[model samples]
Target: RKDIAVIPYEPRYQSAFKALNEEWITAHWEMEEPDHKALDHPQEYILDKGGHIFIALYRDEPVGVCALCKKDDPEHEYELAKLAVSPGVQGKGIGVLLCRTVISKAKELGCKKIFLESNTLLRPAIRLYRKLGFKEIPKSHPAYERVDIQMELVID
Candidate 1:
């Protein structure tokens, strides 16, 4: 097993962050826009909103990332977003490790539930969510317009 460490996002990870977004769009979203610019926009907003971004490093190399957005509602919930793993390092269980870490962090934050939006094109990721105990939920968010699936997990 690789030595995996989760750290908050820092300026140093800009390149790795861009790479992950580019790979995800090229492989799954089929978007032609520059992922770095598109991703950086939201990254800025999330950081400003008390959101937590975690980067997973394996052997000192950035391999994956996940984020938890603090909820605005009084429900004491959160939203998990921007989950990405280096294409070269995928299937090595890094994604799962990142996800488990995010979930644990959310629970520690006293979140009652967590939600996420994902595209149906990503079959493996959808499966991973199910395996992690996330269940399908109604697509009510305006952001769901670009997403094909929405899921939620109740944190105990």
Candidate 2:
């Protein structure tokens, strides 16, 4: 775990972000427009909109990624999304590191809550979210067709 480094978005690793996310998404669920918009141009959809993306590097190679997407709401919430880890490095604590980094970043942004939309098909991911203190919440109007469950973590 000490060898893994979680860093902010960099132009050089843009492809790695898309590739890492697409790996899991395409394998389990079909890619939606929201995925394309975020993965194709992270700067336009995330960074410029006051959101943040974190990438996990293992031995100087990209292995995981997570994004905290700002919501245009009065509550000042962010959607913790696009969490993915390389197939080869699955269950190696990379996802937890990326998520913790995003949670910290959300707090730094003064966010009131962090929510996420996911599908029931990914049981492991759901468990991870729960372990991170995310509780199941009523599903909102999801942006992607794949979302079946919603969870939220109130930032204190």
Candidate 3:
């Protein structure tokens, strides 16, 4: 992880976010409408809506990305969406770095909890979420057809 750096989303990194996510999502499931909404217009869908995205740079090149999409939950929660690490560098701890960045940003934004929708087929990602202290939660009505399990992490 020496060369890894987690930085806030910028317009310049938008393509990286979209491409990285598309790569992973397409590998397992077809791109859904929700995916295009965020990936295509991150500025409007995420940043302008008071959400945040983070990109992991390996030696200054974007290799992974994650987002905390603002949600309507009255409990002040955010949806942790669109996490992806380039396959070439999988298992290098970049995902953990990106997630930690999201958790920190949620605290900074005074969020009560962070949640995500993911499919059970993604064993590695599910494991990572558990390792990051996200516990299994009742699956919500997901926006994507692929989500089978939902998890959440309560923030202090």
Candidate 4:
């Protein structure tokens, strides 16, 4: 309870979101193509589409962010995207808290399943996903050509 808070995205968090993306790219996606515009646009879209976006705060300072995107598929699924914790605070429990928050938010949204894509380079994150009850699934997303692993969780 040490002043960790998760709140919806706001315009004021653009800088923090950018910082998080930079950290994530540097740490886990060094070989992948960097599409700055694509990265920047999703935060705006998530905020505008009534999607759930959460930022973790430590004593009022932004330290992490996560978002849930409603899938267009008729299966009533969701996508968990952009879950990032500050590089400076990586080992703490903030990432776990952020994930739990997203799962709860997904359940609240009536999502029966949730999916995410990750590269194999992110060993820590992959382990975290497994620990959180996510299971590896066959890759089916067309937009994620570089993803080495796909995971899904049944929320219902």
lDDT by residue (tens digit), candidate 1, 1-156: 448788888878867776786678666555433334336654566667777778889899998988787768664468887789987778888888888888998888888789888887899999999999999987765353458788999987
TM-score per prediction, in order, is 0.85, 0.96, 0.96, 0.86
Q: Backbone clashes per model, in order?
A: 0, 0, 0, 0
| Cα RMSD for predicted model 4 | 2.4
Q: 1-156 in candidate 3: lDDT tens per residue?
A: 789999989899999999999998998889988889999999999989989999999999999999999998875479888899999989899999999999999889888889888988999999999999998887767789988998899988
Off by over 4 Å in 1: 30-38, 41-43, 74-76
TM-score of 3: 0.96
Superposition error at 29 for model 1 (Å): 3.0
Query: Per-residue alpha-carbon lDDT of model 4 for 1-99, expressed as tens digits?
Result: 577888877778877876786787766455233335435765556656657778899889999988787667775367777788987778877888888
What C-alpha lDDT, on a 0 to 100 scale, does residue 139 get in candidate 4? 78
lDDT pick, better of 1 and 4: 1
lDDT of each: 0.78, 0.90, 0.90, 0.77
